[model samples]
Target: MLSIDYQQLLAPIQQFLQCETPVTWLDVAQQPAQLPILLTDHLICELKAAQSAMYLIRRYAVDEQSGEALLQWLKPYEDFTYRQQGDWRALADIKLKKSMIPKADSGFGQELIDKMVLLIKEELHHFYQVLEVMQQYKVPYDKISSSRYAKGLLRHVSTFEPNALVDKLICGAYIEARSCERFAKLAPLLPADIGAFYLSLLRSEARHYQDYLQLAEQIAGDAISERVAFFGKVEAELINAADTDFKFHSGQPLAFSAAVGA
Candidate 1:
């Protein structure tokens, strides 16, 4: 029932990313038996996305008090996800108020807080939504190993200050863009409800990537095309290379069929 211009939404994402999600990955992802692993990994990815945004805000924008508050806001999700000690139903009521985050004095601090706050909210909510979907489908969560996709990109980050932050942001952009692109391409091949849910994420995922790029450029005070392109190649290599771990952000599957629904 969702209606939007798919072509227009995905055009920039397609352009930003150097390569598409492999047919082999999509083929494995859409298999009916892979639901548990897909949903579980997706749940973790959402929490991880929120955590990344929180890290950025705490590191670059917010005061210590604000950072701790942000952690408290996300603690329930972490407990449920990692510690396995919470009622998922209660998550719906756990919310972060705008007033809770006290701004600090930093270059582009307000902007970073604003955009990352938005991204954190959405990612957390999407985490809840994924849990809801899993509950409906009776998919149990699982603790799985991390994939090399993110580490591959992070390995090349500069050791310097501004460059380190900028590199991370560019990597963030590539990650978000790739996620959006994959969601779009995989939606139609899945069940209707799941497909719609995946498609629904297109707008925010697209915006998150753009916001990362904008913030990176603002912090860099110069064009980041060269660095962005470098991360683009790195991200593409991770996406295209053979990967053994099958997680939400995993690369091409090597022997992941038996590991499905982890």
Candidate 2:
């Protein structure tokens, strides 16, 4: 069990989420055999988070050359995750390399670069941490299809400029909030070392959720409460409804027999 007040850490996230994770999902997550799949998905989630943050910065904040540098910095990890050609050791040097991010004239641009660069750094570090845990446990990394959770939320993104950006940031907030909430939920059920690691991640994840929300509100330049509520409902439905697959963010697990029968 974690020695910290996890509920206190998660209070804000819990308030942000419209619904709690389903009991059925929690039941399945507690099983010992689910660890490999959980950790593998978690490892990928970290990379995806970093990649998303990088894209936001590249598309809105940085110059073309800086964008290329960002891609190069992420290339080794991506190669390993996607192509399975590179070793984990190749990711070590990436942590030390810093890319230049030129300041943009627009306030939103500079703000995005500032916040997202720090987010990218932390997420990449977390990815490495997940990989370390996976290696220790002999959990091989394999590409798995993404959970329906994110795609469901993203389908609501507006196909325009600032609205698109604002909606994406809102989605980012929900994703991070859910991730933090799930970590707190899962930590106690995991073994000592893994539990401690998950607990260690809470502080950063909390900050990330806040960062995304702040950026969304700032970019929107008005009350985003309604839009936030809209996405909250969408996110809650995804969390609460029945789901067939057992991903880190998947809903209630479909019974094996049910799947076989289908």
Candidate 3:
């Protein structure tokens, strides 16, 4: 029972950004044979996204309530990943975090923290959903190497205080935006259930990107246009470049037949 009216949510998000996701993302969705691998990568990426949010919460958001809420929100995924409790009966009552990060010390910290926590919750929920789907489809889980996408984007950080944080936030915006864009592009290609689930994510994912961009702007208190432009080029290159791994966030497909072929 997906609650999203995807077309309504995605139109504004795509319009707000200066970019559109590449079409190839949907192409992957159409190849159901590849879904197992794609979803495995997707599951890991979701947890990684959640971890990024948790790090921000721990580092900047000083509220104990927010921390507890985060822990509670992530309980299902954490239980499954660490404690191996992903049985069907164990996933019924998953709840999102209740606390919001405060905008006191630095709006940047609180704002990003709030958005990221929600994003993480959704991503992990999505992860759980994907795992369920995988189990139904008989896709076995395996630990795989990460793609160069995140690493490539992270390499551009300024190696200093606010600048580094700013850069990271900007990168986050691109990642979330790209994800939203990809969801929009791919949802229709999937089967009814999975398609509905992906479409359901559009609203939150779009808002998450906007939240990241807004935080980047507020954190700088000045024109981040240049920084955005700088990262735009970098992100575009990473998206367009050649890559061997097939990850949720991997670069342009390498045309190599094998899923993990390096």
Number of backbone collisions per candidate: 0, 0, 0
Which pairs of residues collide in model 2?
none
Ranking by lDDT: 2, 1, 3
In candidate 1, which residue ranges exceed 4 Å CA deviation?
Answer: 1-4, 97-104, 256-262
lDDT of 3 by residue, 1-262 (tens): 3235766666665654555554554455468777877777777777777877776676666477777777776766666665667664466576653757564776566566667767776777777787787787788776667778778888998888777777888888887777887766667777777777777777777887777778778777788989887888887787766666667776666564334343
Which is superior by lDDT, 1 or 3?
Answer: 1
Q: Local distance difference test, per candidate?
A: 0.86, 0.87, 0.71
Window of ten residues with lowest summed lDDT in model 3: 253-262
Output the number of the lDDT-best candidate: 2
Error of 3 at 238 (Å): 1.2
TM-score per candidate, chains pooled = 0.94, 0.93, 0.79
Query: Clash pairs of candidate 3?
Result: none
lDDT of 1 by residue, 45-76 (tens): 88888998899988888888888889899999
How many angstroms is residue 78 displaced in model 3 relative to the true structure, after the best TM-score fit? Answer: 4.8
- TM accuracy, model 2: 0.93
